[model samples]
Target: MESSSDTFGKDDSADAKLQESRVVTEEEWLQKWETNNIGFHNEQGHPLLKKYMDIFLDGRSGLKIFFPLCGKTIEMKWLADMGHQVVGVEISESALKDFFTEQKLSFSEEPIPGIPGKLLKSTTGNISLYCCSIFDFTSTITGKFDAIWDRGSLVAVNPCDRERLVTIAEIYALLMLRATLRPPFYVPDSEVKRLFGKSCDITCLEKVDGLAERPKKWGLDYFWEVLYMLVLK
Candidate 1:
């Protein structure tokens, strides 16, 4: 495993810039979805989620799972089908719509009062998606969840906003994320501890090099994805 400094160092300007670019505005994310530039999405859902299902469930069922920065991820459907209530917060309206349409799930949208967007709920009421900035979608709005699956959400967050986010997590949130570099895009173990250690007990469940074919796509010689489970104390 590379040191956090090695991952976050500015020695590679191109890599640094590429990672920095991921901290884009909500509009930019919306544009990415509109143009179908979502290579971050996994069509079959995340393999780790399946591989570690036992850990997440812990011999329990009827979990209320949460997904942050969810972009038409098929994982939500998978959990809902298993009789768990799935709640997700997404910035792109189109992404939310695509999730329902692609999953062939009947849903209804109701304007979320005081927000710029609406809440889309499946007809079965097992899955709920709120189209709004993640920062705006608070626990007060959606209540609590048994666990949070933060695949790409934390990595895409602006660094300046990270501390505030960590502070907010004091009230709610915990789990894993995907990042190529450290800090704004990639968060190494040290970064994870630095951000959440004070409020949560952090455990790194897994860390692996990116897929053999993905380095070229992300413009990096190597990319790493680390999955951590955080329990707020």
Candidate 2:
């Protein structure tokens, strides 16, 4: 496991350049989903998620779990199967619909009161997916959550929007609770601390290289998966 100080040296100019180059837009994401280019979508519900769920969730049951920038990842359904209510906010309606279609789960779609997109819910009512931008998400609509599972949500956003996302998470935490952030790309521990250290306590940081298949599929030399647990203060 590499420490923050070791990962990020004194001069963070390289990190800044990296973030600048990696900035993405909502349209790009929509296009990715439309063309079925979502290499990030793991059907197995993320290896770390299954392995560390008990420890991260701390034996909580029937909790409301929030998934930000959620693609049609089966992880949401897996979480629902764990006796927890899964609430996911996604910008792409196609992705949301695909989730149900792929999983062969029946769901109903209804327009959100003031939000831009509609809400899709499983017939069993254990899973609810809000098809809207994360910016449009408000407490009035989704209410609060006990835990937030941010798999690739942070890394998917434009670098400029990262802080705004953090602000939203802070507000969500005020009413709800803690978060588990897993960025798809490389994000230094120092940067994570800089973003959430004040409002949340950094409980755990672990580095693992479990997704061996992703790097080659995505045309990357290596992919490091970092697990970060943030306990809201």
Candidate 3:
């Protein structure tokens, strides 16, 4: 007879395969937010970010930081409090509204030229959020970022969109800046090597265990959270 642990392991493996086989669309993500199925949303800034942000800071002040698929994460507020300009791109208008309202930050909205969405700017103009698809991001519009904090944005995207996501990073990242990326799933080092080998140098790659409390699809008690730092070569 199969033990419960064995059954859970099998279920987890099946769930992983299922996720790999499907493409998650923008509308599906919006629905997830609407239903409050956002297990990914962290009320506090991510622990890893709290620990490692100084590496990105490196004695700099007032650096422009970009968060892709930002999703109203408290990390943006934390970054703003650190004296850096926080720019985020999100697709859900509800999430954007919630971010400002919940933070009690006054903001004004205006349309973004050459894009189909509006830009939400905090009263101090230090935090700017573009409500649009990340693919539509352009330097001409948002300008370049001194640093990028991509907490799970890469892993949250469908496999087909991953390459484009990297391209967008390339276009927006400052020449000497480091882009910090965190993947929610198990991303093997070989896969990371394949993706960023040619154009970027990987400065850090660490697998952080026990970071998530929720059981993974395969019912694992904990999953590895991979942190990667990529610098353009």
Candidate 4:
């Protein structure tokens, strides 16, 4: 059931996104952190992440939540603070450091015995951030999760990598994913159905007229923040 504009939910232009075929490299992301060129970086995180917190919890406790391409997101800290374990993967190691340091969470880093990357564990042991590419990550590495919080990961991801992204969030890994679609990475509702419908049941939770509110941000004529709940079928 879809609701209107009060719904909680773009820097890349439609044409630019459409024309760009090369997948964004991990080095580029590292550079974004190094240069502080991350315009999309938000210390506060997505507002809907907090508003929809209950939905993510879904009457559960001690949920192991996953975040793909998590770049120092505040949501992880918030969940960890709430006593849920957070498993996140990102390519930039510095971003992981920033997350722990900025959040004032004490953490220890160690190399994965059989892998090329390292893992940072919060001293309290509720949060684990993987300093590696999302593509190399699996349930085997992070273990299973109860939920997935996908805010910017989908849109920031190249079209080619989407299949892998969706596969990683399969039912075997999590109970559900709250796919919050945002502008600059405008993926329409129809496309969403085509992508997730085969494996998961799709539901539209809310739709907000985001373009009307921030008409100048996306450089586009129209934009809507739509939320989709994808549950394993």
TM-score between model 4 and native: 0.85
Ranking by lDDT: 2, 3, 4, 1
Best by lDDT: 2
Q: Candidate 2, residues 1-233: lDDT per residue as tens digits? A: 23333344444436445665565678888999999888777877777777777766787788888888888888888888889999999999999999999999999989999868899999999999999889889888877778888777766777677799898888775322222233343555566778888888675456665547665776655455667677788
Work out the TM-score per prediction.
Answer: 0.85, 0.87, 0.84, 0.85
Model 2, position 149, has a per-residue lDDT of 80
TM-score of 2: 0.87
- Top candidate on TM-score is 2
Model 4 CA deviation exceeding 4 Å by range: 3-22, 180-184, 211-223
How high a TM-score does candidate 1 get? 0.85
lDDT to native, each model: 0.72, 0.74, 0.73, 0.73
Residue 27 in model 4: lDDT: 74
As for candidate 3, its clashing pairs are 12-218
Of the pair 2 and 4, which is ahead by TM-score? 2
User: Higher lDDT: candidate 1 or 3?
Assistant: 3
| Residue pair clashes in candidate 1 | 181-186, 182-186
- As for candidate 2, its clashing pairs are none
lDDT at residue 5 of model 1 (Cα atoms): 32
